[model samples]
Target: MAETLTAASSHGEHAHGEMSFWSKYVFSTDHKVVGLQYMFTGIFMGLIGGFMAYAFRMQLAFPGVEVPGYGLVSPVDYNALVTNHGTIMIFWVAMPVLVAAFGNYLIPLMVGADDMVFPRLNRLSYQVFLLSAIVLICSFFVEGGGFGGAWTAYPPLSAQSQYNLTPLGSSLWLVAVGLEFVAFLIGGINFITTAMNSRAPGMKAYDIPMIVWMIVVASIMFMASVGPLLAGAVMLFMDQNIGTAFFDPDRGGDPILWQHLFWFFGHPEVYVVLLPATGLVADIITVFSRKKLFAYRTVLYTVFATGVLSFTVWAHHQFVAGIDPRMAHVFTVTTLLISIPIAEMMFVYIATLYGGSITLTTPMLWALAFIAEFLIGGVTGVFLGASGADIYFHDTYFVLAHFHYTFFPIAIIGFYAGISFWFPKMFGKMMNETLGKIHFWGTVIPFNLIFIPLFVLGASGQHRRIYDFSHFPNLSAPWQQDLRILATSALLVMLAFQSVFLVNFVWSLWKGRKAGKNPWKSNTLEWTAESPPPHGNWSELPTVYRGPYEYGVPGRDSDYWPQNEPN
Candidate 1:
């Protein structure tokens, strides 16, 4: 430990040659190391979340079917799976992998900084996140098991402690969620401060890569949007632990207040996740397509426009939640309006690919699929955004399909795009392209198979969160059971494919082909550094002379023009 600290105390990037194993990998302050830690942990949590989904999907497909060890999953058990699945996937898996991991790895490297301005705080951010995950995992073992209240944890249900299935679990769940928020809050502050204050010499605002800019904006949006929910979490916690009636309607507290608070943050949280992905896709597609990103400044403006507009559309989620009827029209307009900027981003992606020397690399496949799939997610949302249509669709499998379409592509696929595109940069070795493409096909096909049937089930009036569809005549109609079985089977297939990715990821780090500094031949600042950059990122940070997406300029000797290449 003493030797580790001694090495860390050394100044400058090159002076860390004596770094002990602990100083170099565990408890390390290096941004790249920290990012990989977030990645691995997040992926682990994702598997847990997937298992939860599998449990509930099994129940849905074959009600009362007994397992080898555990007996038939009770309705209560099904509800718990539903609740924890949503909570863990969104909070633990998606946020950590999509935002925290890459954000930490790329912001400094791409922005031409040595590391985050607040490196220790960055370390602390991940620590708190881990602690939160532990607390959540602990909830599952508490008296009565984890809270059965849905991830939304809408109150009266969540507020009643004595009668609730997992009173202790609910309280712990709140604490876990609140801690996760705090962790990200710390990271968000570091992200914004670093981007605003720590740019290398000669790098101006416009010179900053779109990925960094989008992440910073997303961080700010998160910080701003989360305040109401943070306050709401506190109030709900008090209601659950103390004798407060903040969300208990029987005690003069409005249950609806919780919905408002949750969705206000919840809706903007979607954009908070998506914007970074939008920026990543922008960068990845440009690199693979061999073209300068079309309308780069325009895309940046669209990102800002998307963030600013996100706050206004939060009530779209509350359309059928008994809010004032007149407000629906207002929210509907805002919700529909938000799509214009999103559509602009998609159009620009297509334009960039139009006249380019496109290479359908694994990452490029993910990027292109992200655009195509996310568009479906976006278009379907318009139906739910309309107050009238949502009246029927609320809480149906349709909403489930809609969000999975949006989130699956953006969070799951988008993260893979970035991970695959930058695998060499992150670990200094190539991920096997053949396995990557195989994994891609394995994922994309089964993903569609699972969700498309879900839309059918929803359109047929199958409400979500019900434990036994056989009990309901409308839901248990002849083909409905078959549909459930099919979706569940597809889900298992999807889970099976993820194993391929897991093996490829673990095997490639040591055994894959050596990836030199710039395997992709892309023009980004991070690529200018060594693959898996050393302790301080650069012995001396490179100065940026141009924007990140300067490809295919006429008369250039090579197809790419790097940002640090002097004109």
Candidate 2:
């Protein structure tokens, strides 16, 4: 199989000869190029989302004050910024960077396939994603600015133009989101098909890398879950423009129906992004700790259980949405039950780290931080999962803080970990350790500083959606305002420090130490490929001879054993 693939790759390359710069980089069907396109585009969208966060956080900390680089933000602008920020971060940034980018680049290489099974389809996926991003950005310039009805786009406000006062923006937002979903659906098909069918000749299910399995599972979960959300988006778009009242109570439409559809996918959407990050962390931890993953099959089973249970817990988000007490209780139970498997996965990671020769490299630090920080998010989530507690905490800054704790780690920290670990293979250069560590501390510390204060403010009865708490005397206590200011100030510090990372990334690209293939001396098949692997990855595709995590084996000259290396 390896030889056959190699012959085909060589023939294709020879026939194509040298591609033009645009064909090679822009319009190429190569999985690697498409993956890089997803990555760079996601990063660019992240910057836009981050700036939106900056603008809104500034408005919250100092109401009625003119912000630098942004003028005085009105109530509508604040809502739009907050809404679009969440939308872009999740759909544009997290999905693209975590799933689309890494999945495209790593699947073929890790599985020893020549390319994605559907190469042209992969290119189409990215092109659609880029188009979705453009539509979303264009929403901001449309008549009344971007949609301000929150990222969830719950009806009456999202449905009725008079209520939200941005008919065009809302429709555009819905269309953009729907288009983004279509893009991922296309990409997900490619991920599942390639990982399942195109693995090296000798690689069995268990022999494939954990990350590849994870991405495949995530793709399946996404394809299964996103259908309802896509259908709901269509309904909402109709409600917005066609005078349809799908979610309008007065028109005999059930608003809660939208909640059911959204959360059905929304909760699972959390795990869709999360599984890949955790899988990435799994590979990273084993490599840095110099140990075989403890209970690899157990971890895989736990992930499957997590995915199955994830579907059952969606209604926990609607605990306070006037759901029946019985249904809320049921969802609460399932929600709490789902935590067990996640906890088991976390313990499995710790067991992998136990009694191993651990190296705290930059990637290792981010991996460790993901566990610690996401643990906080999970713990706080238990409170919101309960029907009783959620009644009080819903829509508070506490909820906001809990959300950031979870998603920031999943989306931001996970990206850093994967990128840091794979930087050598991705760019063929080693990032400066000092600069990496500096950026790590700069990011993680300020992250906590920003959110902890929000937790405190939320506990003090602060509502998340208020434009100005000063107008409400009870919510505007001096201490509460102080905490708000501290949170915003910390956000500023965090955003400013990101410049260090930008500098480090560009500088290391040209001036950093050379990274030959397998700089980490890891055992994955991807490590067997060249640094920044050329077109078609390798002259000869490798045959897998072992599982990915064969570290610290006895009677071996080397502690690590590459999967492609013959015994």
Query: TM-score winner among the candidates?
Result: 2
Per-residue accuracy of model 1 over 1-567 as CA lDDT, tens digit each: 223222234334534567788877777777788888888888888988988888888888888898434567887777778899889888997788878999999998888777888888888999899999999999999988998889998888887766567898999999999999999999999999989987766788888888889889989999998999999999999998898999877788998889889988998899888988888998999999899899988888999999889988877778777889888899999999999999998999999999999999999999999998999899999999888999999999999999999999977999899999999999999999999999999999999999999999999889997889888887898798998999999998998899999889989997989999999998888998898887777766677788888889899889999888989
RMSD after CA superposition, every candidate = 3.5, 1.3
lDDT of 2 by residue, 1-567 (tens): 223667245426422568899989999998988999999999999999999999999988899999899899999899899999999999999999999999999999999887888888899999999999999999999999999999988887888888787879999999999999999999999999999888887999999788888889899999999999999999998888788888999989989999999999999999999999999999999999999999999999999999899999999888777989899889999999998999899999999999999999999999999999999999999999988998999999999999999999999999999999998998999998888999999999999999999888888778988999999999988998888889888889999888888888999999989999999999988888889988788878888899999999999989999999998
Evaluate all candidate structures by whole-model CA lDDT and list the values in order.
Answer: 0.88, 0.92
Candidate 1 global TM-score: 0.96
TM-score quality measure for candidate 2: 0.98
Which residue runs does candidate 2 get wrong by more than 4 Å? Answer: 1-4, 7-15
